[model samples]
Target: MGQLLVVRHGQASFGADDYDVLSPTGEEQARVLGAALADLAPDLVVHGSLVRQRRTAELLAAAAGWDVRLREDPRWNELEDLAQFAAVSGSPDGLDRDGFQQWYDAAMARWTGGEHDHDYSEPFVGFRDRANAALADVADEGTVVAVSSGGPIAAIASVLLAGDATTYGRLLPGIVNAGITRVISGRRGLTLLSFNEHQHLPPELRTYR
Candidate 1:
Protein backbone atom coordinates (compact mmCIF):
# COMPACT_ATOMS: atom_id res chain seq x y z
CA MET A 1 0.00 0.00 0.00
CA GLY A 2 1.11 3.54 -0.72
CA GLN A 3 0.93 6.62 1.47
CA LEU A 4 -0.19 9.86 -0.03
CA LEU A 5 0.50 13.18 1.59
CA VAL A 6 -1.51 16.04 0.17
CA VAL A 7 -0.27 19.56 0.83
CA ARG A 8 -2.06 22.77 -0.06
CA HIS A 9 0.16 25.39 -1.60
CA GLY A 10 1.65 27.97 0.73
CA GLN A 11 -0.04 31.34 1.04
CA ALA A 12 -0.39 33.05 -2.30
CA SER A 13 -0.67 36.65 -3.32
CA PHE A 14 -4.44 36.37 -3.11
CA GLY A 15 -6.34 39.02 -5.05
CA ALA A 16 -3.18 40.41 -6.61
CA ASP A 17 -2.85 40.96 -10.32
CA ASP A 18 -0.56 37.92 -10.41
CA TYR A 19 -2.11 35.66 -7.88
CA ASP A 20 0.03 32.80 -9.07
CA VAL A 21 3.03 34.03 -7.14
CA LEU A 22 3.60 33.22 -3.51
CA SER A 23 3.98 35.95 -0.94
CA PRO A 24 7.13 36.20 1.22
CA THR A 25 5.28 34.68 4.13
CA GLY A 26 4.14 31.90 1.87
CA GLU A 27 7.74 31.16 1.00
CA GLU A 28 8.67 30.89 4.65
CA GLN A 29 5.67 28.67 5.31
CA ALA A 30 6.72 26.32 2.57
CA ARG A 31 10.24 26.18 3.95
CA VAL A 32 8.99 25.39 7.41
CA LEU A 33 6.73 22.68 6.10
CA GLY A 34 9.60 21.24 4.17
CA ALA A 35 11.76 21.12 7.26
CA ALA A 36 8.95 19.44 9.15
CA LEU A 37 8.73 16.67 6.60
CA ALA A 38 12.44 16.30 5.93
CA ASP A 39 12.67 12.97 7.64
CA LEU A 40 9.90 11.45 5.58
CA ALA A 41 12.11 11.36 2.47
CA PRO A 42 9.20 11.07 0.12
CA ASP A 43 9.88 8.90 -2.94
CA LEU A 44 7.83 11.09 -5.23
CA VAL A 45 7.04 14.77 -4.98
CA VAL A 46 4.38 16.12 -7.30
CA HIS A 47 2.85 19.55 -7.72
CA GLY A 48 0.33 21.26 -9.93
CA SER A 49 1.64 23.28 -12.84
CA LEU A 50 0.37 26.51 -11.30
CA VAL A 51 3.24 28.72 -10.23
CA ARG A 52 2.30 28.91 -6.60
CA GLN A 53 1.97 25.16 -6.27
CA ARG A 54 5.19 24.51 -8.15
CA ARG A 55 7.02 27.09 -6.13
CA THR A 56 5.89 25.47 -2.92
CA ALA A 57 7.25 22.14 -4.05
CA GLU A 58 10.53 23.76 -5.08
CA LEU A 59 10.90 25.50 -1.75
CA LEU A 60 10.12 22.31 0.08
CA ALA A 61 12.65 20.33 -1.90
CA ALA A 62 15.30 22.95 -1.29
CA ALA A 63 14.73 22.96 2.42
CA ALA A 64 14.56 19.20 2.76
CA GLY A 65 17.85 18.72 0.88
CA TRP A 66 16.33 15.80 -0.95
CA ASP A 67 16.83 15.22 -4.66
CA VAL A 68 13.57 13.37 -4.96
CA ARG A 69 12.05 13.29 -8.40
CA LEU A 70 9.53 16.09 -8.80
CA ARG A 71 6.69 15.71 -11.22
CA GLU A 72 4.44 18.45 -12.59
CA ASP A 73 0.90 17.28 -12.90
CA PRO A 74 -1.84 19.64 -14.04
CA ARG A 75 -4.55 17.53 -12.46
CA TRP A 76 -3.54 18.98 -9.08
CA ASN A 77 -4.31 22.56 -10.07
CA GLU A 78 -6.87 24.56 -8.14
CA LEU A 79 -10.45 25.40 -8.97
CA GLU A 80 -10.08 28.85 -10.54
CA ASP A 81 -13.67 30.08 -10.47
CA LEU A 82 -12.66 32.73 -7.94
CA ALA A 83 -11.05 34.76 -10.70
CA GLN A 84 -14.28 34.71 -12.68
CA PHE A 85 -16.26 35.47 -9.56
CA ALA A 86 -14.11 38.51 -8.88
CA ALA A 87 -14.55 39.72 -12.42
CA VAL A 88 -18.32 39.35 -12.36
CA SER A 89 -18.78 40.79 -8.85
CA GLY A 90 -16.13 43.50 -9.10
CA SER A 91 -14.21 42.33 -6.05
CA PRO A 92 -11.28 44.50 -5.14
CA ASP A 93 -7.76 43.31 -4.43
CA GLY A 94 -6.39 42.02 -1.09
CA LEU A 95 -8.83 39.35 0.12
CA ASP A 96 -6.84 38.91 3.35
CA ARG A 97 -8.39 42.11 4.70
CA ASP A 98 -11.97 42.78 5.76
CA GLY A 99 -14.20 43.98 2.91
CA PHE A 100 -13.23 41.13 0.58
CA GLN A 101 -14.75 38.67 3.04
CA GLN A 102 -18.33 39.53 2.19
CA TRP A 103 -17.59 39.47 -1.52
CA TYR A 104 -15.64 36.21 -1.15
CA ASP A 105 -18.41 34.63 0.84
CA ALA A 106 -21.02 35.52 -1.74
CA ALA A 107 -18.79 34.37 -4.58
CA MET A 108 -17.93 31.12 -2.85
CA ALA A 109 -21.59 30.44 -2.25
CA ARG A 110 -22.30 30.87 -5.91
CA TRP A 111 -19.30 28.82 -6.99
CA THR A 112 -20.04 25.94 -4.61
CA GLY A 113 -23.77 25.95 -5.30
CA GLY A 114 -23.23 25.55 -9.06
CA GLU A 115 -24.91 28.90 -9.69
CA HIS A 116 -21.89 30.01 -11.68
CA ASP A 117 -22.47 27.50 -14.44
CA HIS A 118 -22.24 30.21 -17.05
CA ASP A 119 -18.98 31.53 -15.65
CA TYR A 120 -15.83 30.86 -17.65
CA SER A 121 -13.94 28.44 -15.44
CA GLU A 122 -13.54 24.78 -14.62
CA PRO A 123 -16.75 23.19 -13.46
CA PHE A 124 -16.89 21.41 -10.11
CA VAL A 125 -17.28 18.01 -11.74
CA GLY A 126 -14.34 18.61 -14.06
CA PHE A 127 -12.14 19.72 -11.18
CA ARG A 128 -13.10 16.63 -9.21
CA ASP A 129 -12.33 14.28 -12.06
CA ARG A 130 -8.96 15.85 -12.65
CA ALA A 131 -7.95 15.58 -9.01
CA ASN A 132 -9.23 12.03 -8.77
CA ALA A 133 -7.21 11.00 -11.78
CA ALA A 134 -4.08 12.56 -10.34
CA LEU A 135 -4.57 10.71 -7.08
CA ALA A 136 -5.22 7.45 -8.87
CA ASP A 137 -1.81 7.73 -10.51
CA VAL A 138 0.03 7.35 -7.22
CA ALA A 139 2.12 4.18 -7.14
CA ASP A 140 2.13 1.77 -4.24
CA GLU A 141 4.92 1.03 -1.70
CA GLY A 142 6.44 4.46 -1.36
CA THR A 143 5.33 7.81 0.00
CA VAL A 144 4.04 10.35 -2.51
CA VAL A 145 3.68 14.02 -1.70
CA ALA A 146 1.29 15.94 -3.90
CA VAL A 147 1.41 19.70 -3.61
CA SER A 148 -1.91 21.23 -4.64
CA SER A 149 -4.48 23.81 -3.69
CA GLY A 150 -7.23 23.76 -1.11
CA GLY A 151 -9.99 22.85 -3.52
CA PRO A 152 -8.28 19.85 -5.08
CA ILE A 153 -7.10 18.64 -1.70
CA ALA A 154 -10.63 18.87 -0.37
CA ALA A 155 -12.00 17.09 -3.39
CA ILE A 156 -9.55 14.21 -2.89
CA ALA A 157 -10.41 14.03 0.79
CA SER A 158 -14.10 13.99 0.00
CA VAL A 159 -13.70 11.06 -2.35
CA LEU A 160 -11.67 9.21 0.25
CA LEU A 161 -14.33 9.85 2.86
CA ALA A 162 -17.68 9.50 1.09
CA GLY A 163 -16.93 7.88 -2.28
CA ASP A 164 -19.10 10.42 -4.14
CA ALA A 165 -19.52 14.04 -5.20
CA THR A 166 -22.36 15.19 -2.97
CA THR A 167 -20.34 14.58 0.17
CA TYR A 168 -17.39 16.57 -1.19
CA GLY A 169 -19.51 19.68 -1.69
CA ARG A 170 -20.80 19.47 1.85
CA LEU A 171 -17.45 18.75 3.54
CA LEU A 172 -14.80 20.68 1.61
CA PRO A 173 -15.18 23.89 3.57
CA GLY A 174 -12.85 22.80 6.37
CA ILE A 175 -9.70 22.40 4.26
CA VAL A 176 -7.09 25.16 4.56
CA ASN A 177 -4.06 26.27 2.59
CA ALA A 178 -0.63 24.87 3.60
CA GLY A 179 -2.33 22.09 5.46
CA ILE A 180 -1.53 18.37 5.27
CA THR A 181 -3.96 15.54 4.69
CA ARG A 182 -2.88 11.90 4.76
CA VAL A 183 -4.35 9.03 2.78
CA ILE A 184 -3.27 5.42 3.08
CA SER A 185 -3.89 2.88 0.35
CA GLY A 186 -5.50 -0.33 1.52
CA ARG A 187 -7.29 -3.42 0.27
CA ARG A 188 -10.57 -1.59 0.02
CA GLY A 189 -9.03 1.57 -1.45
CA LEU A 190 -7.59 4.87 -0.26
CA THR A 191 -8.40 5.47 3.37
CA LEU A 192 -8.37 9.02 4.68
CA LEU A 193 -6.09 8.91 7.70
CA SER A 194 -6.19 12.60 8.43
CA PHE A 195 -7.44 15.93 7.11
CA ASN A 196 -6.11 19.48 7.48
CA GLU A 197 -3.20 18.90 9.86
CA HIS A 198 -1.17 22.10 10.53
CA GLN A 199 0.15 21.64 14.01
CA HIS A 200 3.71 22.13 12.79
CA LEU A 201 3.08 25.84 12.34
CA PRO A 202 2.72 28.31 15.13
CA PRO A 203 -0.53 30.11 15.84
CA GLU A 204 0.51 33.19 13.91
CA LEU A 205 1.35 31.14 10.83
CA ARG A 206 -1.97 29.35 10.75
CA THR A 207 -4.40 31.39 8.73
CA TYR A 208 -7.48 30.26 6.88
CA ARG A 209 -9.27 33.58 7.17
Candidate 2:
Protein backbone atom coordinates (compact mmCIF):
# COMPACT_ATOMS: atom_id res chain seq x y z
CA MET A 1 0.00 0.00 0.00
CA GLY A 2 1.23 3.48 -0.83
CA GLN A 3 0.89 6.35 1.62
CA LEU A 4 -0.46 9.79 0.89
CA LEU A 5 0.29 12.42 3.49
CA VAL A 6 -2.25 15.26 3.29
CA VAL A 7 -1.48 18.32 5.34
CA ARG A 8 -3.97 21.06 6.18
CA HIS A 9 -2.30 24.35 5.54
CA GLY A 10 -1.39 26.34 8.66
CA GLN A 11 -3.51 29.07 10.16
CA ALA A 12 -4.17 32.02 7.92
CA SER A 13 -4.67 35.67 8.82
CA PHE A 14 -8.03 35.19 10.47
CA GLY A 15 -8.80 38.83 11.23
CA ALA A 16 -6.43 40.55 8.91
CA ASP A 17 -7.61 42.29 5.74
CA ASP A 18 -5.77 39.69 3.69
CA TYR A 19 -6.78 36.25 4.89
CA ASP A 20 -4.81 34.28 2.33
CA VAL A 21 -1.41 34.66 3.97
CA LEU A 22 -0.20 32.55 6.89
CA SER A 23 0.15 33.93 10.38
CA PRO A 24 3.40 33.85 12.31
CA THR A 25 2.18 30.91 14.38
CA GLY A 26 1.23 29.15 11.16
CA GLU A 27 4.80 29.36 9.82
CA GLU A 28 6.07 27.86 13.06
CA GLN A 29 3.51 25.10 12.84
CA ALA A 30 4.58 24.23 9.29
CA ARG A 31 8.20 24.10 10.35
CA VAL A 32 7.36 21.86 13.27
CA LEU A 33 5.37 19.49 11.04
CA GLY A 34 8.23 19.40 8.55
CA ALA A 35 10.71 18.44 11.24
CA ALA A 36 8.33 15.80 12.54
CA LEU A 37 7.91 14.16 9.12
CA ALA A 38 11.59 14.45 8.12
CA ASP A 39 12.17 10.72 8.34
CA LEU A 40 9.65 9.79 5.63
CA ALA A 41 11.56 11.23 2.62
CA PRO A 42 8.60 12.14 0.46
CA ASP A 43 9.05 11.96 -3.35
CA LEU A 44 6.62 14.66 -4.41
CA VAL A 45 5.40 17.76 -2.60
CA VAL A 46 2.15 19.27 -3.89
CA HIS A 47 -0.09 22.06 -2.64
CA GLY A 48 -3.12 24.15 -3.45
CA SER A 49 -2.51 27.36 -5.34
CA LEU A 50 -3.66 29.55 -2.47
CA VAL A 51 -1.02 31.69 -0.85
CA ARG A 52 -1.28 30.00 2.50
CA GLN A 53 -1.11 26.51 1.03
CA ARG A 54 1.81 27.38 -1.23
CA ARG A 55 3.71 29.07 1.60
CA THR A 56 3.16 26.11 3.90
CA ALA A 57 4.42 23.67 1.26
CA GLU A 58 7.52 25.76 0.66
CA LEU A 59 8.29 26.16 4.35
CA LEU A 60 7.70 22.51 5.08
CA ALA A 61 9.94 21.42 2.19
CA ALA A 62 12.67 23.78 3.32
CA ALA A 63 12.47 22.66 6.94
CA ALA A 64 12.43 19.00 5.97
CA GLY A 65 15.23 19.57 3.43
CA TRP A 66 13.32 17.76 0.68
CA ASP A 67 14.75 18.40 -2.79
CA VAL A 68 11.50 17.86 -4.69
CA ARG A 69 10.08 20.88 -6.47
CA LEU A 70 6.74 21.99 -5.04
CA ARG A 71 3.81 21.36 -7.37
CA GLU A 72 0.63 23.47 -7.56
CA ASP A 73 -2.77 22.06 -8.37
CA PRO A 74 -5.83 24.27 -7.92
CA ARG A 75 -8.06 21.28 -7.39
CA TRP A 76 -6.52 21.06 -3.92
CA ASN A 77 -7.59 24.61 -3.15
CA GLU A 78 -10.28 25.51 -0.61
CA LEU A 79 -13.93 26.25 -1.29
CA GLU A 80 -13.20 29.89 -1.97
CA ASP A 81 -16.54 31.64 -2.34
CA LEU A 82 -16.58 33.98 0.62
CA ALA A 83 -18.94 36.48 -0.95
CA GLN A 84 -21.47 33.79 -1.66
CA PHE A 85 -21.27 32.57 1.91
CA ALA A 86 -21.65 36.05 3.32
CA ALA A 87 -24.64 36.69 1.10
CA VAL A 88 -26.25 33.40 1.96
CA SER A 89 -25.59 33.86 5.65
CA GLY A 90 -26.70 37.52 5.68
CA SER A 91 -23.43 38.62 7.26
CA PRO A 92 -23.53 41.80 9.26
CA ASP A 93 -21.27 44.83 9.07
CA GLY A 94 -18.56 43.27 11.22
CA LEU A 95 -18.29 39.60 12.13
CA ASP A 96 -16.11 38.48 15.03
CA ARG A 97 -14.63 35.01 15.20
CA ASP A 98 -17.59 33.44 16.96
CA GLY A 99 -20.09 35.31 14.83
CA PHE A 100 -18.31 34.35 11.68
CA GLN A 101 -18.20 30.71 12.73
CA GLN A 102 -21.90 30.72 13.39
CA TRP A 103 -22.62 32.17 9.96
CA TYR A 104 -20.00 30.06 8.25
CA ASP A 105 -21.51 26.90 9.66
CA ALA A 106 -24.93 27.87 8.41
CA ALA A 107 -23.54 28.80 5.03
CA MET A 108 -21.61 25.57 4.82
CA ALA A 109 -24.71 23.56 5.56
CA ARG A 110 -26.72 25.33 2.91
CA TRP A 111 -23.93 24.96 0.40
CA THR A 112 -23.61 21.25 1.00
CA GLY A 113 -27.34 20.66 1.08
CA GLY A 114 -27.52 20.63 -2.75
CA GLU A 115 -30.47 23.02 -2.73
CA HIS A 116 -28.52 26.20 -3.48
CA ASP A 117 -26.30 25.04 -6.28
CA HIS A 118 -27.26 28.11 -8.23
CA ASP A 119 -25.97 30.39 -5.47
CA TYR A 120 -22.37 29.24 -5.44
CA SER A 121 -19.98 29.47 -8.34
CA GLU A 122 -18.76 25.96 -7.54
CA PRO A 123 -21.23 23.63 -5.90
CA PHE A 124 -20.36 21.15 -3.16
CA VAL A 125 -20.46 18.13 -5.46
CA GLY A 126 -18.16 19.83 -7.93
CA PHE A 127 -15.70 20.73 -5.18
CA ARG A 128 -15.74 17.23 -3.75
CA ASP A 129 -15.23 15.58 -7.15
CA ARG A 130 -12.29 17.80 -7.99
CA ALA A 131 -10.74 17.11 -4.61
CA ASN A 132 -11.19 13.41 -5.17
CA ALA A 133 -9.52 13.71 -8.53
CA ALA A 134 -6.60 15.55 -7.00
CA LEU A 135 -6.19 12.82 -4.41
CA ALA A 136 -6.32 10.14 -7.06
CA ASP A 137 -3.61 11.87 -9.08
CA VAL A 138 -1.28 12.22 -6.09
CA ALA A 139 -1.89 8.80 -4.52
CA ASP A 140 0.63 7.27 -6.91
CA GLU A 141 3.66 5.27 -5.79
CA GLY A 142 6.18 6.59 -3.28
CA THR A 143 5.50 8.89 -0.37
CA VAL A 144 3.38 11.83 -1.58
CA VAL A 145 2.81 14.92 0.54
CA ALA A 146 0.10 17.48 -0.26
CA VAL A 147 -0.67 20.82 1.34
CA SER A 148 -4.32 21.82 1.13
CA SER A 149 -7.04 23.68 2.94
CA GLY A 150 -9.50 22.13 5.38
CA GLY A 151 -12.53 22.11 3.06
CA PRO A 152 -10.99 19.93 0.36
CA ILE A 153 -9.21 17.66 2.82
CA ALA A 154 -12.44 17.04 4.66
CA ALA A 155 -14.19 16.47 1.36
CA ILE A 156 -11.67 13.79 0.41
CA ALA A 157 -11.88 12.09 3.78
CA SER A 158 -15.65 12.20 3.90
CA VAL A 159 -16.06 10.64 0.48
CA LEU A 160 -13.60 7.85 1.27
CA LEU A 161 -15.03 7.16 4.72
CA ALA A 162 -18.78 7.48 4.27
CA GLY A 163 -19.62 9.07 0.89
CA ASP A 164 -21.80 11.65 2.63
CA ALA A 165 -21.88 15.40 2.94
CA THR A 166 -22.59 15.14 6.66
CA THR A 167 -19.25 13.46 7.13
CA TYR A 168 -17.56 16.38 5.45
CA GLY A 169 -19.38 18.87 7.68
CA ARG A 170 -18.37 16.87 10.74
CA LEU A 171 -14.74 16.71 9.65
CA LEU A 172 -14.14 20.30 8.53
CA PRO A 173 -14.32 22.50 11.62
CA GLY A 174 -11.96 20.53 13.82
CA ILE A 175 -9.09 20.28 11.34
CA VAL A 176 -6.16 21.91 13.12
CA ASN A 177 -3.71 24.29 11.52
CA ALA A 178 -0.94 22.32 9.82
CA GLY A 179 -2.63 19.06 10.80
CA ILE A 180 -1.68 15.78 9.13
CA THR A 181 -4.05 13.26 7.54
CA ARG A 182 -2.87 9.98 6.08
CA VAL A 183 -4.51 7.89 3.39
CA ILE A 184 -3.47 4.45 2.18
CA SER A 185 -4.03 3.04 -1.31
CA GLY A 186 -4.37 -0.72 -1.24
CA ARG A 187 -6.31 -3.66 -2.58
CA ARG A 188 -9.46 -2.18 -1.10
CA GLY A 189 -8.70 1.16 -2.74
CA LEU A 190 -8.21 4.37 -0.77
CA THR A 191 -8.58 4.23 3.01
CA LEU A 192 -8.47 6.94 5.56
CA LEU A 193 -5.51 6.13 7.78
CA SER A 194 -5.83 9.23 9.99
CA PHE A 195 -7.46 12.63 10.13
CA ASN A 196 -6.34 15.90 11.69
CA GLU A 197 -3.29 14.51 13.49
CA HIS A 198 -1.46 17.40 15.17
CA GLN A 199 0.64 15.75 17.85
CA HIS A 200 3.81 17.22 16.34
CA LEU A 201 2.71 20.78 17.13
CA PRO A 202 3.19 22.38 20.52
CA PRO A 203 0.07 23.40 22.45
CA GLU A 204 0.49 27.06 21.56
CA LEU A 205 0.81 26.34 17.86
CA ARG A 206 -2.40 24.38 17.52
CA THR A 207 -5.05 26.52 15.82
CA TYR A 208 -8.23 26.12 13.81
CA ARG A 209 -9.39 29.13 11.80
Q: Which candidate achieves the best TM-score against the true structure?
A: 2
* Clash tally, candidates in order: 0, 0
Residue-level lDDT of model 1, residues 35-57, one tens digit each, is 98888978999999999999999
Kindly report the root-mean-square deviation of model 2 from the true structure over all alpha carbons: 1.4
lDDT tens per residue, model 2, 1-209: 77999999988998699999999988998999999988888888999899999999999988888888688999999987587777666864587778877777788889999998988889999999999999998776568999999999999999988769998888988999999999998888899999899999989999998
Q: Which stretches of candidate 1 lie over 4 Å from their true place?
A: 86-99, 114-120, 139-141, 163-173
Write down the lDDT of every candidate, Cα atoms only.
0.81, 0.89
RMSD of each: 2.9, 1.4
Whole-model lDDT, candidate 1?
0.81
Candidate 2 has an lDDT of 0.89
